[model samples]
Target: MPDIFFNFLACPLGSYCPLATLNRNTGICEPYSYQLPPGQPSHTCGGANIWSDVRSSSEVFCSAGSYCPTNTEKNHCSSGNYCPTGSTAEKRCFKLTSCNPNTASQNIHAYGAMLIAALATLLLIIYNCSDQIITVRERRLARSREAAAKVVKEKIQARARWKTAKEAAKKHAVELQGQFSRKFSRKRNITVSDKVTVLNEEYTDTDGNSYPSHEHSTSLVSKKSQSASEVEEIGSSPLMKMINEIEEQTFDSSESFSLEIKERNLKTKKAKGKAIHTHSQIFKYAYAQLEREKAQQQQNNNLTFSGVISMATNTDYKKRLVIEIGFTDLTVTLKGKKKHLLRSVNGKIMPGRITSVMGPSGAGKTTLLSALAGKTVGCTISGSILINGKSEPIRSYRKIVGFVPQDDIVHGNLTVEENLWFSARCRLSADLQKQDKVLIVERVIDFLGLQSVRGSLVGTVEKRGISGGQRKRVNVGLELVMEPSLLFLDEPTSGLDSSSSQLLLRALRREALEGVNICMVVHQPR
Candidate 1:
């Protein structure tokens, strides 16, 4: 018998015979039966082709390379070529073919190339810019340090200059005091005969103007002496100039003290033009304006009320809000009950056409006017008010009414021009531009006879701080500056004597004739 080797065959088999059956029907082969390893095929059963051997004899097995003798018994691998291995010799399993290894390596090599290219670009950029970046950073730091140093130097220099200026001022003050003392002493020691000789001599003033006569000469001498006294009192250094400068420096000889004075005067004039009127009339006017504003606001809401009204322009006008014994019966009323203490029961209001509310005390005159002006404090009122021929609520009617109460509303610190200019500004009219404001101020000043006191501080007026009459006119003047269509005045002539009151009323009456509604509340009138 020939030596036999077994192949583990994996194929459909039926039942469980342990060994495969052999067929010795081939012409040149001798029968063989052997098992070399466990799980190996012992024999081939039969085959018309080469693969009918199976380890289990009960069923048929087939190899991939062979055709079944019967069509129903055909066998073949599904996915790949069948290959046998040492671990599975008698049987076969499918194996997938491999791709070229060189192609896979090429893909990995391409990824590495991209990464290297990016890294090289980044490194090159950094290498080229590093020095420039460092230089820019260093320059920025240097500039910062230089700026800080300069600021410190400037601060130190400013401090030094201030100290020097202060020292110089102190020294100058001492010199001025000495000069003043010596000059006074020398003048006192001069004999009467020597004074006469000096007066007889043709002496020129600092301005180079000759003295006109003996009396004029004496006056000039006195003026010169006063000027000298003023110089000493103020000190010799340019203290005045220093006062005006933002920083300290030496005074210029060509810079005249008179120029400084003129500048001061101009400043004072400008300031005066900006002052708010704080006189009795202004308060009265503000009160009236407040009432008018109140009425107008109410009207804006479609409510009905009444109040005092005043209006004026370049000409003087009067509008008075007065409450008298009979004013309660007028076409106006309060929304609530009246409280007598919080309200004036009796007073007169003279506004425009009714330019004078003249009545005795306790006449409910002021109360009536306050009621009309929408300012009856602590008082219950009931009635309708008519304005512009309409029975509008006082709150809605405020915009049209201008009121001046019976007190001085002139600001004590402001000049007359300042008062009017501020008055014009406060109204905030689109028409009241800078030029219009100046003209308005000028007109008001002239109208109220305030030109002389235009530059005078209201606080320093000699007699009663701007005569009661002038103060009253200013009260009215402030209101007229706005050119309100309606105006009110309360006790406008209260403190004025007969003539002043008459003049004030006459001015108001004249304005009334020109179609400006004028009203005044006067306790007494000439």
Candidate 2:
């Protein structure tokens, strides 16, 4: 029955047909399990037939470098193509790939190289485009700043001219009024004396004072001449001459008049819409407002010594939060050693004041600041640090604390504005408005006198940039932009000239007015 079944049956592709004899004991085909016997002699093995692992035929299986479409057929791979054992079709080789006829596989080194080239090209394009974009943005910002500065200068000049003209006109009007009053009085006196002569009597005044006499008349004429000479002298003075010249030029020059008119129109537009969109416009608006405020303060005499004394004495002016740091018996000892970094340091830093820590080299000024700021490392601190007269860890208010190291720990690649802006964004309150943040950054830049160098790079040793003094101020500005409640500085004025140091101190003094608790280490007492 198995032979009859095998006579009509044929093996499919990937398999082979073979002759087999029946096994009488097991009732199965001989030399193979679960295979039926072939009835005809023509049915001989040509390829692999048995599919069972127990009776596999390696000699009849498909060979390498070739494939079998049928169990009894085989084909060679064509040129520029590759094929592995049992492949039904050849594969075309990749470009630059090595593939000979009847090859088993194509080399992939060319594909890897192409992939690497593509990736490198992509990276190069990205880098170049990014650099170009940054350069363009910086240029635009610089131009904007220059335009703003120019506008501010023009506005200030126009204001000064107007003020000078007003003052000169007022002086001239006063002189004319004085001369008119004197002439009228003289005529009236002469008329009264004529009337007295006609009546043949003398005019007497209260307290037995006589009427206008010859000596009085002569004195009055002399005073008139002197005042006229004084007026002539003032008109010939350099200041008056300059004022007159400026007025003449302003009125005579069409270009100057047109420019002034344009400025007025721009101001009117600004006031009507408040459409200050660009950086230059914003800067111009802000500066104009600031100037107006300054002028108002000057006119009001708000910055007088008496006003300052009153502001200092008034408790209501201290509205911001005050942080007072008082340390008693502060001692910092090195771990596992008896040596002390700071011994018995007793002092307090008050709010709304600048406390200077002064000492010679290695006198532990930095150490004391570090200890107060809670930045001491690898040391055992033993002391009572009181915050607002209460014992508390400095870390509790670390969010409001700022520490500036002696080293200029700033990004050399970043501009002064960028460094300060990054610090402000990261350190300021998360909910702060962008306008407020911009205001803070601009204020810091203006106070530090970094306006000129705001767009310039902070610079590295390899690439020279702003001066060392400006860089140092930028370093301080980083912390100032954060509006810290308690600020600590280490050698902030170290390497600064006298003028730069004074500027820095003035900025710090302004901060102190805002109730910031400031403590800094200074090498020079002056």
Candidate 3:
């Protein structure tokens, strides 16, 4: 709502203010109008310093009565008295009486005219202060509004935190429940099956001894051939026979239940394995499995993969900078969320060799590279990066570590040669003459094979200019002109074709051979 109207005595204190006024002025509270020039911030008075804008961090506090005095013209009260209406030399507010003592009959008429004048003056005072009064009300209300908004924002954040905690708790509970069920819960029940016929073997020749004592004739008892007498005897078995029957029935029930449980578990496992998986997710899971197999086969290989790659450039290069950088237990973590992005990563990059760090997506590849280059200052880094086996300070490390980001940050308008020349002049030593810088740029251009697109503009993505691969090479050349000892490239061939990527990798390999330690993050190796 627009705070165009002002209420009297609604400021910090309920006193007669030269500033505050009534919303609907009718011979009551007076409001002053003070028009501000364009582009000036409007200030509202809240009893000298009672209320202010929330963003107004710098609050000006004043001693008692330092700013505005009560009910004086300096205070802009218009009337000399604090009381709204009265009759004294100051109280005859705006009333004027005629000086006609001789005409006593017209005295009443003159007094009435004087009263009208005073009332008119009061109205004029209130009208003049409308702007100031409205401004003060708005400012005071703004303070309250901002406070309310802050509360709402905090509540929303708290609610979000609570919701996240709830989800985490639910997940933990479900995991615990599943673990307990697997570890402790009985998976199958033992129950008696339907009626089973007991087995019986009979040898009539052995019992009688008179039939045939020579070779006993074996005969199987047919259930139908048993007489009613035999059936009754089987039912009314001995105690031992009854016990055997009961034990057998119980054992059979338990075995059948165990078989049922095993079958159910197999079905469930097959269903879970049949669940759909995205390409990346499947790759991650399969990669974990492959890692297990590799661990088992760890003894097969005697050769070790070195974290450090030593490079000695071909003797042809005039200036060879040997930069050996090693990191021990490098770690990076998020501030507010306490999430560890890079955890205890250790590696080494020495001049004259290309050491590529390959990993799946979201493996902290970029974070690790940026941290080594000091580009990840926003994150909390806890590790020591040693240069040449010594603890080199960040300032010195930054000077030597040349990093090429995934995105090309070159000026789109400048030509390829011009870009390299300017970059050389900026990073090259001041002691080196202009010709020296030019020579460095020329040498970089010649080696990188960017001479074909030297004069051509490195135009915008849509505009005509050099090819994507050439532009990328120019970006590298811009850094190469600096003659940095250690170079870090982050996914340099990310958006390039297979051939372009190989060409880029080859150029880096050549640089490594020349003794510039090159470390790059590549999605895959050729």
RMSD of each: 29.7, 11.7, 30.8
- TM-score per prediction, in order, is 0.35, 0.62, 0.39
Per-residue lDDT for 1-526 in model 2, tens only? 3334433445545432345566667756644455444576554323223343213434344455665677657777777888765566677887788888878889888889999999999999989899899889988877876687688879899999987877787577557556755765775676566555533433443235655566655665675576667657756767666556655664677467435534654675556365556777766665665455345346335567766775566564465578998899999999978789998889889998999988889999999999999999899899899999999999999888999999998999998989998999899989865545666787788778887788798899999999999989999999998888899999999899999998899789878877899999987987
Stretches of candidate 2 above 4 Å error?
Answer: 1-122, 201-277, 289-302, 309-320
Model 3 residue runs over 4 Å out of place are 1-318
Q: Who wins the TM-score comparison?
A: 2
lDDT-wise, the better of 1 and 3 is: 3
Ranked by TM-score, the better of candidates 2 and 3 is 2
lDDT of 3 by residue, 248-286 (tens): 655776689636535644654553366434333332333
For residues 1-526, what per-residue lDDT tens digits would candidate 1 score against the true structure? 2113223333333211223344335322222243234354553443222223344331333333332433234333222223211111122332223223111111245556778999999999999999699668756644543454455456657987987877677577557656756866675556444566665664544236755467866776786687667656655447444443422333542456326534644654564466444233222323333333334345434523321222223122223232222233343334464334223233333333555666678766666667777786545665445554456666664655678877778787776766777888887476543544544554456445665666565664554456556777787888878765567788777677776666566556545544556565665654
TM-score of candidate 2 versus the correct structure, residues matched by position: 0.62
Candidate 1 at 507: error in angstroms?
2.7
Rank list by lDDT: 2, 3, 1
TM-score ranking from best candidate downward: 2, 3, 1
**Candidate 3, 115: how far from true, in Å?**
69
> Can you give the lDDT of residue 369 in candidate 3?
85
Clashes of each: 103, 0, 19
